[model samples]
Target: MILTGYLHQQLAAAGVTRAFGVPGYFVMPVWHAFRKDPQIILARHEGGAAFMADGYARATGNLGVVLTTSGPGVTNTATGVASAYQDSVPMLVISGQGSPTTFGRGVFQESFLLDRSASPAALLAPITKTALEIVAPENAAFMIDTAITLALSGRRGPVHLSIPLDQQQLDIPVPPSRSASPPTVGDVPAAPCVLAAAELLRSARRPLILAGWGSMLARAQPEIARLSTQLGAVVVTSTKAVSCLPRDHPMLLGHFGPGQRSDIAQAVSSYQPDVVLVVGASLSRYYANPLAAVLENAATIRIDISAEQVGFRMRADIGIVGDAREAVSALTSAIAAGGTDTAAEPDCSAAELVSAFQKRAERAALRQKPESHGMPSVAGTISRLSRMLPPDAVVIPDAGNHWLDTISLCRAGRTGGVQLNCGVGAMGWAIGASVGMAMAAGQEGAAGRGPLTVCVTGDGSMLMHGAELTVAAEHELNLLVVVFNNRSHGRVRLGQRLDFDREPMGTDIPSIDFAQWMSAMGLRTFRIDHADQVDEVLAAALATRGTVGVEVLCHPDEVPACLRGWIED
Candidate 1:
């Protein structure tokens, strides 16, 4: 058997029923195995394939798998892999490479695949917990196991197992254990530090919880909520962490980003609790803006899986190096043991906070309307799309101006609906992710439901990997892809329009017929030129079946939702 066969078996045993990729000569052995496996999903672009894996991992919490050919194939997927790594999603990326014999000789598409693995791997390493390459076939199982262990370890993330083409072909002995086991989480120490931290929370009258991406990774939401309710803490989020708590949550403060609720900021500023508990979120200036100065006097407790985060820029009174999920559970148990149950819930205050924040959001949306000046604005467009989506539909967001705009218009949560580019903000991520989300939803099978997945993207980013549209049609995925046709790089346009004082440059590009392209792919398509046409087209697209796409042609000058203040006058 080729090592590829053994790798396939290992992945199957690891519960990876699907692998996504584009095939090429360098990766033929792995591709052959994938084809024979009857489980892999062959995608059109290497980037799209990786994103499919990303969506799978996001939906199932299982290790998503992706494969690619060498050089350009692998390079094409760097952004997607990096996004998975950054977001700490568990993924296994196996890219075929030039045989070790040609690695340094520059034999056709050959770069330093192994020696230089650490460089790109380093970039991903900051984002990922571990990365490696397989030099020999015998090392395949070990590397595979290692990748799984690292990916599901302290901070789950993407693991690269770069296998030379020769390695993929070489038959190797099976290791005693074929199935990869996730790494074991070490015992979290609940020392005097945790006790003191508990005391801080226990004593605080108005405690506020700021959960970040780390908290979600730690599975700290339930525990954090328990602690917050007990302590009367207001819970807010960093930009990417909006989904950790329900946006409709009474105790939930709105997201911390551009166009965020002014009242949430005011509440945070006004309530300025004596104790601030930050779990898994980096204590960056993004969340602590204007409030950074206020943090000087407040007691801070930071717990994260990444050691670097514990003392990155700010000093924490209590810092722990345990896994976030474990640490939170331990902290929650300790608080519970301390007779921390409070019969009096802060329901009334939470309701007031949510109401105040919504009012501010409404006012801000109104303020942005006048700035549109007849152009189709991102904020308004997303607002329409959000309403058009079914109550249970999954929204796939890629990274770019359009994605940022969608965030402002919609609310994402673990309870479902919005799935964002949380970790890495990978561009060209939406189309494939939409397919994955659609597949997952279709598997659930509810009668009378609309399209299960909706993808909102920009024209420029869509072109980057637009070929994936064919894969969606081929897979018979019922996905609704909405393109914001602003006829330019929306982000760059925003930058040029704002930074250059309205003398925009290098941002304008001629629009291509995206809807036509999708239609040619044998998928249903719709084109809309104005904001008024969006809801109607969206309704029709959702009503129609089997991967319908809508293109919204808008003015290039319209600013995205969050950047209106900075990007517009």
Candidate 2:
């Protein structure tokens, strides 16, 4: 069997039903082999292909696959690959390279340099968990299997494989058998560390549980909630884990980080916990560096699959290297067995904490009411949209002030409902990502029926990859794209205004009629300038078939309140 056929069979065996890419000469052979297998979703750009794959993985919790060709094709995918790397999304990037025999011949789109070993593999090495060049056809199966395993391993991330054109077309006498599944890491933590953590939580007067994306990846939401309830602790999530705990969970204190809402910030500042249990989070600066300062005096028990991530950005009093779900379950059981210290002083009862949180949330809502004049506020629109959407709707928010506003307003009712490109902070991701997510969710019994897949992006972001909307329309995907059309890069302008005290330059954008463009692309389009029109237009868009694009004219100066505070500070 040929190597190309073997590769496709292996991908199918691993449960990959779809692949995204832009076809090129180097990869034509493999493309032909996959013509009948794993439906290929043609993308307008290699970057869009990679972003689509990234979105598919996020939505389905499966390894996303992207195929591209040599030179510019592979280079174009760098941004998307980097974004996936930063977010720890599992993906396999297969780039077809010039033949190994023509390494120094300077063939068409040759990626290899004359003096060094620098090639597409080398270029992608830094951003991927593993990067390999398949020089030998015999090694294709091993390389493919290894790349797949590494992508899904601890601290999941993308892997790259550069296959020579000749190697891809090579036909060996016998095809290699499918490799065994990757070895699983044990979920149990060290006995001594678990005991110490249990004791600290059992005796602490004020305890907090901080969950991150790792918890969501581990499917540890139930364990986290159980632990929070048993220990009478408040739950605060990282931005990436916003939906790990339901928005209305009694013990939920809301998200913690730079983009936290004013009310959540107040609550986090006023209610200082004596101990914080950090689970499955990197404690990165995206949440703000001050998180470490806030918990400086508190006992911190950090549990993560990666030992390096245990004390990545903050000090950990007790570090446990294990799977989030298993470690959390063990800790809860240990705490139960150790018996709670009933005599320990309670700083605030669970009921009192919940009441305080609800009051703060109410105050925040009142403060965020849209004014009677000017374009609609991004936060206010998101708040209303959150209420209108179904409980299990999946929202993919792009990076920018728009996303920051979403973090403060939108609430995810179910786990893994909100997918944001926070790690790479890449614009234009949500546009293509929403298509992949909608495709995944539309599958029978995949995410249940009638679950809306929505992409919330800014004008700049929409223009970057809005071409993918055609893909959604062509596939008849159930997707909605809400574009905040502020006619400028609001975040960049905000930075310039605050940092340099200068009027924005190169930030303003010409007003593009996105509705018209989307309509031409066969998608239902709506253009609205007032908040009053939002509900009706959104309902109409949702009611329409396939994909819908809503272009909302927003105030350029309407920055997220959280971002405003950061700039002021």
Candidate 3:
């Protein structure tokens, strides 16, 4: 067997039988290998394909693998890879590079093909834990192992490995030892920090659990919920962490962010919690203004799997570097051993605090009506969709103004009910991700409970590789893709209109009947012209067994006042 074939075999051995990519000249040989392998699944666009891998990794907890050609192919996949990187989702990205023969010589597709000369592998260095270029076929197996190891190791992230065209096509010997192995979890260090964290939780009168994307990636939901329950703490999630807990639970406070339903910033500042336990969150600037104010006067205990994350931005009072779930388990064990009796007598005021939060949420939900600018309002759409779908339905939103609306309105009672693009905020995430998620839902009996998978994307987002609906149709995936047809980039248009004090230019998109287009692609379709008709259209779409697209054409001028305020602030 040749080196290229052996590499494909290694990918298969690692449980990544499917490989998605956009072919290019440099990757021709590798593409041929995948075509002959009978395992790899080719995709249309690099970005959409990589996101599909992300969804697969999330659902199965296996290292997702994707391949692409150098230059444009690799560049196009930046957003999705960054999303996986930021969220700590394990993924392996193999890209074909210009031949080593073209090193330093001006050649086609030779943009820094070797030494950080604008290569996608170099671009990914800052975001990824490991980035390597295999100039020789012999090093391919070792590099593959290292990349896989790092991707599945502490604080999982995407790892980039580039193989030069010459090396990939070479008829080099395939070493039997080159076979890829299943990634193994390493040792867990003793967590004395857990004892310190437990003491802080015991001493604090008011405590809050702030969970993030890592919570979902690390499967730390149960551990986090247990900790919150034992300490009588309020549980809140970031925008991307919506499904980290059961929203209907008494202790759950819903999402906290610019678009979240609850006034978490106000609550955090005014409520003055004595302790804030943030687990698995990277503390992105979008999540809070400074985070220091939110944690001020509060004993902050940060638990993350990576040491690099400990002092990255928000300084932790007590930093514990290890698996979030394991650290949480240790903390809970310590707390239980020194248990304080809170169960015998309920804290009267704590119950009131929970009620107050719920009341505020209900009031906010009611007041979040459509504000007419001209087109359909994003917030109103989200609220409407929230009402139409079953309480446990999964809402996967692509990044954009529409995402803001969905985050604010769509309510998921528990983890796995709702998923969002939290980390890198990629635009085309929902459609592909919804496909993967819907397949997972059906296999897991999500439909038996009610409506399963739903995707809401803005017109711009929908136009970007929306053709992936073919994948859905081909697979007969149970999914609904709800398009907010504004005929423009709604968020950018609003920014230009409000901030630039001018009508949007270059942002407007040619209007298209997406439902009709999708229907032609062999899927059920619905187009809603009026806001009033949204409920019925959305309801019908949810009930469909196969792929369906409901296009809601709204005036592009319509913008949420809250969003406008956010821009101003």
Candidate 4:
């Protein structure tokens, strides 16, 4: 069998049915392999291809495969691949390199002869878990298996494989074998550590649980829920892990840190948990800094699959290195074995805590009257759209002020429904990611003829990868993109206004006629301006078939309530 055929077979056996890539002469063999087997979704740019694969992996919990040619193709994918790396998404990137025979010669798109730094494998090594260059056809199988294994191992991330065009096209006799299994790091934590953690939880009157993206990736929601319920502890999720539990859960205290509502902040500070069980979370500044001062006196027990990450960000009194699900399950079992007693007369019940938090949030929302002198307020628009969408629909918010606004207003109703590249803070991610997410949802058939993705991106972000809308139109995907057209980099301008108190330059951009542009590409387009028109325009866009774009003309000066809290202070 040909090497390409064997690669296809291995990928199929590993449950990879779909891939994303841009076509190039060097990667023609990859196209041939994917022609009839694993379906390949075409992208306008290699970066978009990488983002699509990243989104597919995040949405499906499967290995996302992306193929591209060498040189510019690989370099173009750097940003998306870097985002996946930072977010710890498992992805396999296969790049077609120059023929093995022409190693010294400057073949087309050959990076080695041009510059060593330009080599795909060399450039991706820093970002990917592992980057391998296939020098021989016979090494393809081993390298492929290794790449896949590394991708699924602890601290999962992207892996790169630079295969020469000749190697990819070679016909090699290979023995049939099963796909490589994901690496299994032993789940058993040191018995003493587990006992100590249990004891800490048992002794603390107020205990809290912090869940992160690792919890979601490990599917530890059930264990997390059980542990939180058993201990009567409040659960606070990172922004990326907002979907780990339903927003309506009684024990959920809402997302932690700078963007938290006043009610949540007051409750957390007033309650002042004595112990915090940090599970599968990085405790990075983005999620944990604001709570750091508050949790300074709390005993912290951190659990993570990566040993290096266990105590890297926060001081951990007890650092347990193991899979999130297994570690949480073990702790739960240990607590039960220890016969830990529940509080008879606690300071407050979980129900009471939740009620107080909700009351505060309601008060805050009431105080935040729509400030739309004429145009639609961003917060109001997001709130309305959140209510209009189905409970299971997926929402991918791009980076910038819009991301902060959307997260502040939108409640993620379904587990694992909200996907964001908060790790890299990359703009233009949501557009390509939405395409991949919609495809994954469509393939799953769970949405059932309804729109699967609603992407909220700022105008600056939309313009970067807006061309991918053609891909959605070409595939006839049920996707709706809502662009906040503020005609400037709203985040930058806001920062300048607050920090310098001067007119901003380079932040402002010319307003593009997005509705006309989308319509020209065979998509339904809606132009929204006034606050009163949001509901009608959104409803109409949702009802339309295939791909639709809704451009909301927004005021550049308007900032979300959450942002105002920090800016004013």
Candidate 5:
């Protein structure tokens, strides 16, 4: 068999069952090889393809693969790749390149070569863990295997490979039988770090657990819950790691940071815990800075996959450098062995959490019943939908003012999670990502009936990549997309008005009825003009199969207060 066929075998053997991309001239060789093999979900744009791959990886906890023709195709993946890099999602990008014989002869799709200083590899290097090219057909297996390994290993992120058409087509000896790959991540450090962390939580007057992305990547929710219970610690999460503790877990207060509601931030900041345990979160300015009053003088135990990010901002009283699951597991075991005070009173912070949540719930209840039949509150709309959706529905929120409302008001413990792109803050990431997630979920169940996947997006995001919705229709994937049509780049408009103290420019969107637009894409559509209509319309959309869209009319000015904090801070 040729190198292309063998490469496909290797990927499949490694459990990479799906790929996302768009076809073009330079990639015909790949298309011919993949004609009926591991399916490639066609995307409207190269950027959307990468986003789909990222979403697939996030949903399945596997390596995501994306292929694109060289030149413009390679460049178009910039936003998606960078978002994956920042969010630490494991992904592989395959860029089809021009033949070696055409080096710099101005080939039609000449994207990269070792000789060019401004090549595509150079452009993508900073965003990828590695950017390599297949120089010879014989090295194809080794190179592809290496890319997969790097993408799945510690501090997981993306890797890029550029394959020349001739190299992919050349006949080469089939590589020897595949050997089992090495462990994806290293083992936890020996018991000293664990012991110190255990002792701190065991003896502290007040202990708090802050779970974040690392814990999610580690799949250590059980371990985290165990530790929280053992120490009677109040738990909070970063925006990226909101699902780290099941939403229903008693110890879980809420996520605290830029994308989360301000009440949780106020609670954590005012609680003044004596000890802080941060799992898998970098605690960047957005997350850490908000709770400065809590962490200011507290002893911290930091566990993270990356050593560089463990004590990135605040000094750690004890730092464990390893996978979050292993580190958290070790801590839990040690705490149990040390004899936790099971009879002790619950942490004071937990009561504070209940108070904060009660206040938010009361406000949410009031907003749920707006007196006038005017536009519904964005948060109220999201809160109502959160209650209606099943516990397993995968909710993805795009970046916009609507996103702020969704993250802040959308109740957690859904298990499917309210997934968002907290990295590059890309506008339409969820729109494209929903397709990949729906496709992945569908593969695990009946073809068109998987976990109900929903994308909550703003009109601006819909305008950017709404074309990808057609892919959902083409595949008959179960999906319901909600468009919070505030009729402008809502976030930016709010920012300009609040921060700049000036008239908004280019933020106002021309009137375009998204319900009509979604219908044009062959999706069942629902238009929501009143607050009372939300439940009825959303229920109708959820009941339908394939792709369905709900366009909610929102008041342009009403947005979360934290939206202003995100802009000025």
Candidate 6:
């Protein structure tokens, strides 16, 4: 059997069922192999392939895989892969390199061989947990196993493996031993930290569990729910973790952080958590800085996988370095031993707390003019779409105003999540991700199998990945892409106008009929202008079996609620 064949078996054993990439001659053998296996999907570009794999990983918590040939293919994938790394999504990228005989020879896409100056390994080193080059054919299986394990280990992120062309075609007589399943790491150590944390919580008057992207990475949703019920705790999450608790959950006060709903920010400003139990978060400024005043006054107990972040932005009274799920489980068991009488009766019921939050949100919305002339606000459209979507849908937002709007105005449903490119705020990230997510949901294969994917992006982002729509049409993916047609990089414009007090420049983008463009690309498409058309347009778009795109004309100067204070007439 050839090395490529053995590689497939290894991936299959590790439970990785799909790969994404575009084909190139340097990796021609892989193209032939893919035809026989057909486990890999063809993508429009290398970057799109990377983001697609990222979506698959987030949806299933499985290792996402992408393949590429040499040279520009490797370079094109860097930004997407790096964004995933920052978000700590588990992924592996496989690249084909020039043959060993070509070392130092001036061959196409063989710059790595010429001087080792522009090697793919060096290029991806900073973003990956580890990057490796398989120099020998016999060592391929072991290296493959190592890369997969690293990707799944502590602080889950991406890993890179490059295969030389000839090495992939090598014959092997003996089958390499494979691990039966993917490795799991990061568990709570049996230490005094758990006891110390429990003691603090046991005597607390008010407790809160603030979750983050890391919490979801640890698959601690059920544990979060259990702990909230265990302590009558108010639950909040970061932007990426909006669905860590269900929208309708009584104890769920919604997420906190920049651009999150005003009620959560108000809650953080008014009252403090006597004992703040932060789980799986690094307390990056993106989520933690906004709640600085409230947290600084609280006695904190943070549980995270990284020791460096156990006391990230502020000092923790008791810090535990472990897996989020394991730590939460351990802490729950410890707190339970003391009894359930720890929490005092609140001033209001859980239902009342939720109700008050809703009322505040309603009042806040009413304060703002929801439309300018005929253009609907991005906030209004997002809310309308959320109401019409199923509870299991996944909503992805690209970088810019639409991203902020989703964070500020929306609440995730019972099983759905808001997946964002907040790691680096890549502009066109969500377009391809929506395709990958829909496929992972198995929405195309059968009814009721998985959630629909909705990608909310801006026009500046749309042009970057218009080609991905073709891939979606080919798969007939259960997806809806809502392109906010503002014809500018809205975030950059905000910075220029609000921060610098200067008129926007170079932020303008060529306008295109997004609905027409999507229609031309084979997706069912709709165009919306008036506020009244939102629900009806969304219904028509969602009703289509395949991929759909809804282009919404949004008010250019309508500021998101989070930034409402800085507005000028």
* Residue pairs in clash, model 6: none
- Winner of 2 and 4 under TM-score: 4
Cα-based lDDT for every prediction? 0.70, 0.80, 0.73, 0.80, 0.79, 0.79
Q: Write model 6 residue lDDT over 1-569, tens digit each, in one string.
A: 67787777667777776789988877777656755332888999999999999988888898888899888888999988998899999999989888878867867877373465378888899999999988876677678778888998888899998888888888754343453554656665456989888878877767878898888988888888988887777888887887787677778877766676544666755546788898887778777777787787888888888888776678888888899989888888988887766545533455466567766664554445546557877877876776678887788888888788786666677644788777877878898888888878776564334567888988988889878878888877878899998878888888899999999898887777999999999988899888778778888888876788899987667666577641121
The TM-score obtained by model 4 is: 0.93
- Give me candidate 3's TM-score against the actual structure: 0.87
TM-score between candidate 5 and the true structure: 0.93
Candidate 5 residue-wise lDDT, 1-569, digit = tens: 67778667666766777888998887778766765546688889999999999999988888888988888888899999999999999998988888888877777866645445246678789999999888887677778778888899888999998888888888766555543442355666568888988887877766889988878877787888887877778888888876676566776777876556546666666666789998888888777677777777799888988788777887888999998888888888787787745434446657567556655554653454431236776767777787788778888999987777677666665543778789899988999888888887764244348678889998999889899898887787788899988778878887888889988888888888999988988888998888778788878877877788899888778756355332222
Cα RMSD for predicted model 3: 4.0
Q: Rank the candidates by lDDT, best first.
A: 2, 4, 6, 5, 3, 1
| Alpha-carbon shift of residue 467 in model 2 (angstroms) | 0.2
TM-score of each: 0.87, 0.92, 0.87, 0.93, 0.93, 0.93
Model 1: runs farther than 4 Å from truth? 35-38, 101-106, 111-131, 178-192, 340-351, 362-372, 413-416, 422-424, 440-451, 564-569
List the candidate 4 regions with Cα displacement exceeding 4 Å: 113-117, 173-192, 340-347, 366-373, 443-451, 566-569
**Which residue window of length 10 is worst by lDDT in model 2?**
441-450
1-569 per-residue lDDT for model 4 (tens digits): 67788778777766777899998888899778897547788899999998999988887777888989887889999999999999999899998888867776777777784544367877999999989987876677777777877887778899998888888878775645534443443456777888789878877778889998899988888899999888888888888887778666778878864356645656677778888899898887876776886668899999998888886867789998888888888889888887745523334665688767755654554444433556777777876787788787888899777787677667777777677787778889999888888887663342225546888988898789988888888777778889888899988998888889988778988978888888887778998877778889899888876788898888888877686762122
* Per-residue lDDT of 141 in model 4: 76
* lDDT winner: 2
For candidate 2, give the lDDT: 0.80
